[model samples]
Structures are given as C-alpha cells and as structure tokens.
Target: MIIGYARVSTLEQNEALQTDALDKAGCERLFTDHASGAKAHRPELDRLLDVIRDGDTLVVWKLDRLGRSVQNLVDLMNLLQSRGVGFKSLTENMDTTTPGGVLVFNVFAAMAQFERDLIRERTNAGLQAARARGHKGGRPSKLGDRERARIRELYQSRALTVQEIADQYHVSRKTIYSSIKNTR
Candidate 1:
C-alpha cells in the first residue's frame, strides 16, 4: 500500500503539485495539511502515521513536503522504520527499502541541516547588529510614547473619554487600557 502526504504553508495555497506527483507515483491514499511545514503540529501527517501498518509505504512528493527541518525528517524516517513501514520520496528518487536510497536520504538530510544552521547563524548576527543600533524588534507599540503621554494627560484632565482616546489613536479600548497600564 502506498500512502501519500501533501502539505502547503497557507490556507490559500494549493496542493496540486504534491497531489499530482503522488497520484502519478501510484499513491493509494493521500493526506494533506494546510499548515506551515516549520510548525510541529501537523494533523494530517499525524493521522497518516497513526494507522500506517507494516509493509505500507509512506510516499511524499518531495522530502521538504514532509518537513522543513532535516532533524524532523530524520526523526520521522526513524519512526517509520521502527514501525516496519517503508518510505519513498518522488522528487528525491529515494526509497528507504533500497541501500542507494538510504545513502541519498542521509546526504540530503545533512545538507538540509547545514542550510538551517546557516540561516540561524545569519539571523542571530543580524538581530545583534540591529540591537546595537538601538532598534527594538517584535510588534511596534500600538501608540508611540508621545501619543500615550497625550492620552494620559487628556484622560486625567477628563478632557477626553476612553472611547474618544481610543478613536483618536485608531486603537481598540483594550489597547487604550493596556497603554495606560504601561504608563504606570
């Protein structure tokens, strides 16, 4: 039995490419997920893993369709191997049942890990540089310091209502309250 898996990063993304390849490769059933591959939570993949029996071959259009991380791919492969289930990747031309496939998959896994590490190193270096320049990361404040001060003054003086302050700042009432709390 050949069970295929397909995945896409977003709800709007289509699964045609993976599905088509899986079908062409003689996949008997296909599971899909419309979630980021980086996310650890993949319901469809989990479901596929649950009912897959020994002698069943889990097929994916590409290794990346299975996971964005090399470690994750290796982990999944190990889990499948322990279950006595085989694995195949259409694009990578790999089948775990074959000696050549094992070698190719290992090499690909190593390269993927190297790529992920490089990205992590570069991102950390860039973030450190940005911090040195006094640049803050993450979501920007709903209101700037000047706007918050004005809101505080107006609110204390009863010159502006909470609703009015919120409207002026183009923020919700909850955000207005949170801003006040931060001031304290």
Candidate 2:
C-alpha cells in the first residue's frame, strides 16, 4: 500500500501542489495536515502513523514536507525503518527501501533545509530593501488625507451618526473611526 502525506503551514499556503503530486504518484490514500511544522500536534500525521501497516510505503511531495528539521527527519526515518514501512520522497527521488536511497535521504534532507534558509534570507533582504525605499508593505489606505480630515471634522462635530458618515464616505464605520483616531 502507498500512503501519502501532505501539509501546509499557514492559511495562505495551499496544499494543491502536494496533493496533486501524490495523486499522480498513485497514492492509495493521502493524509493532509494544515498546521505549522513547528507545531507538535498534527492530528492527521498521528492518524496516518497509526493506520499505516508493515510493507506499506509512505510518500511525500518533498523531503521537507515530512519533517520539521534534520534531527526530526532522522528520528522519523528511524521510526519508519523500525516499523518496516518504506519511505519515498518524490522530489529527491529518495526511497528508503534501498541502501543508496537511505544514503541519499540524509544528504537531500540537509539540502532541503539549506534551500529553505536561502529562500527566507532572500525574502528578508527584499523586505529590508523595500523599507529602505520608504515603502510600507500593507494594504493601501481606504481614505485619502483630504477625506480623512473632513471625516475627522464631521466626527468631532457629532452632527451625524457613525453609520451615516460611513455611508457618505462609502467605507466601513471602522475606517471612519480609524481616520478620526489617527488625526488626533
């Protein structure tokens, strides 16, 4: 039996890539976990470990998908070996059922961690460069400075309800409140 595992760390992270690959690889069943690797409790991972039987092969899209760190990966691989379950990583072409595959897994796991570190470093450097150019990276303001000033005046006068002001400005009450608060 071939059992696949898929995971995504955050809401913005999609599992389609992992799932699609697993499907193509002909996984008999796939387990998905939507939680950070740093998080200890992965319900689906626990479930997958429980149900996987001897002579079964566990597949993953990438080496990193299965482990949080190299140490954790080593521990997991050891556990899988003891249980008589084979492990395969599609991206690294690693299958622990073979002696060469076992050798490649360790090297590939380290390379995966290195690749992730490089990605994070590049992202941080890019953000720092953007900040240097005075770009505040977030959603653009809903209201302009002129409109904000007018909203502040109207709010101070207390002549209209917040809902009325919001309706007039075509924005939410929260926006109006924020605009008023920011000017003070």
Candidate 3:
C-alpha cells in the first residue's frame, strides 16, 4: 500500500499540487494537514502514522512537506525504517527501497547532526561571552526596593488585599506576595 501525505503551512496555501502529484504516484490513500511544519502535532499526519502498516510505503510530494528540518526528516525516516515501512519523496526522486536512496538519507542525517552540533557550539559561545560582559539573562524583577517596601507596609497595615495591591501595581497576586516576602 502506498499512502500519501501532503502539508501546507497555512490554510491560504493550497494542497492541490501535492495531492495531484500523490495521485499520479498511485497513492491509494492520502492524508493532509494545513499547518506549520514546525508544529509538534499534526492531526492528519498522526492519523496516517497510526494507519500505515509494515510493508507499506509512505509517499510525500516533497521532503519539506513532511518535515521542517533535516533532523526531523531523519527521525521520521528512522521511525518508518524501524517499522519495516518504505518512504518515497516524489519531487526528490528518493525511494528508500533502493540502496542509493538509503545512502542519500544517511548522508542527510549526518549533515543534520553536524548542523545541530554547530548550533549548540555557537549558543554556548554566545552565553560565555555574555557572562564575561556581566550579563545576567533572566527577566528583571517587576518590583523595585521602594515598591516592595510599600507593598509590605500596605500588607502589614491591613490596608490592602493582595489582589488589590496586585491590581494597583498592575501585576499578579503572586508578584505582590513575593514583594511582601522580599521586604521581610
């Protein structure tokens, strides 16, 4: 069984072209999603995965239609391979049933891993540089010393409720409570 999957980032984008290609490729059943490829959950794709069986082939119009990143594509391919399923990308002319296709996918996975490592290295370098510059990355406190002291005074005097203080300060009740704690 050849099962087809199609995806577009937004509802404004049409899936007709992909559907046509899948149909031409002789897909017996098709699933589609009109959502960003970066999203973790895609309903139609999830359903397709649940329905596809071992010995089945999963077809897509293009590689990007199936995944947003190379790492994601490699992960999906690994899953399909482990399940004894084959994968085919019409536009890329990639068919995992062939030796050449497997080689190509292996190369792609290596490149993806390399890219991830580069990104991690850059992020760590950036953080180290920022620390050297005396930069602390967390959000600044909402209340300063004067505001915290006032909040504590108001609470001690029994003049204002936590919710009232929060409303007056344009913050949450939790923030007011924390401010009171800081004063003590």
Candidate 4:
C-alpha cells in the first residue's frame, strides 16, 4: 500500500497541491496536517505511522513535509526502514525500495550525522579553550558583595521576607535563598 502525508504550516496555507500530487502518484490513503514542521507532535503523521504495516510505502509531496531538519528526516527514515517499511519523496524522486534510492538516503543520513559530530567537536573545543583561560561557562552572578551582605542582614534581622528581598534586589526568591545558604 502507498500512503501519502501532506502538511501546511498555517491554516491559511492549502494542502491541495500536495494532495493532488500524491493522488497522481497513486497514493491509496492520505493523511494531512496543518502544523509547523518544527512541532514535535503531529497528530495525523503519528496516526499514519501507527497504521502503516510492513512492506508499505510512505509517500510525501516533499522531503521537508515529513521532517523539520536533515537529522529529523534521517531519524524518520531509519525508523521506517527498521519497521520494514519504505519511504518515497515525490519532489526529491527518492524511493527507498530501490538500491539506488537506498544508497542516496544512506549518503544523506551519513552527511547529516557527520555535520552534527563536527559541530559537537567544535563546541567542546571552544568550551575547553574558554576554561583554559579561566572563564567559566554559566551566567554571571546577579548579586555582588554588597547585595549579598544586605540579603544576609535582612534575613538575620527577620525584617523582610524572602520575596521582599528578592524584589528589592531584582532577583528571584530562589536566588535569595541560595545566597543565604552560601553565607551560612
């Protein structure tokens, strides 16, 4: 069975074009969603995944319609392949059921993974260089010595509530509590 999936980012956008293409491509069933690709949950897509069986092919008008990013596309392909299902992208002319298509998809997935690994390596190297320069990587402290002293004095005097001190210092109640604990 060939199942089609179509998506539009906003309500104003129409899925007619994708649906027409899918129908022409011999899609027996269709699922549609009016949601952003960046959204983590897509109801119709999830339903299609749940209902598709082994040996079925999942078709999309375009590769981007199925996933938000290259990594996401690769992940979805991996899942479908693991389940013995195939994938086809109309615009990309990709069909995972064929040897050439499989090769192409594999190459794309490898490139995405390589890019992610390179990014991670570069970020780690940058962080290590910063640490070597005695620069820590968290947010700078919001309260200084004077503020800390005032917080301690207020708490010790029991004249102001934690919330009151937080408002006076433009900090959060949690910050006031943490400062007090550090002083102790």
Best by lDDT: 4
Give lDDT: candidate 3, residue 166: 91
What's the residue-level lDDT of 108 in candidate 4? 98
Off by over 4 Å in 1: 107-184
lDDT of 1 by residue, 1-184 (tens): 9999999999899999899999999999999999998889799998999989999999998889997677888889889988989999888788988988878767877887888899999999999999999999999887889888888887889888999989988999888888888887
TM-scores of the candidates in the order shown: 0.59, 0.57, 0.78, 0.78
Candidate 4: stretches off by over 4 Å: 128-136, 156-159, 182-184
Candidate 4 lDDT, 1-184, residue by residue in tens:
9999999999999999999999999999999999999998899999998999999999999999999999999999999999999999999999999999999999999999999999999999999999999999999999988888889999999999999999999999999999998877
RMSD of 2: 9.3
Top TM-score model:
4
Candidate 4 minimal-lDDT segment of 10 residues: 141-150
lDDT of residue 181 for candidate 2? 90
Sort order, lDDT high to low: 4, 3, 2, 1
Clash counts for the predictions, in order: 0, 0, 0, 0
Better of 1 and 3 by lDDT: 3
- The local lDDT score (0 to 100) that residue 121 gets in candidate 2 is 100
lDDT of 2 by residue, 1-184 (tens): 9999999998799999999999999999999999999877789999999998899999999978888877678778878888999999999888998999978866766776787799899999999999999999989998999999999889889999999999999999999998989988
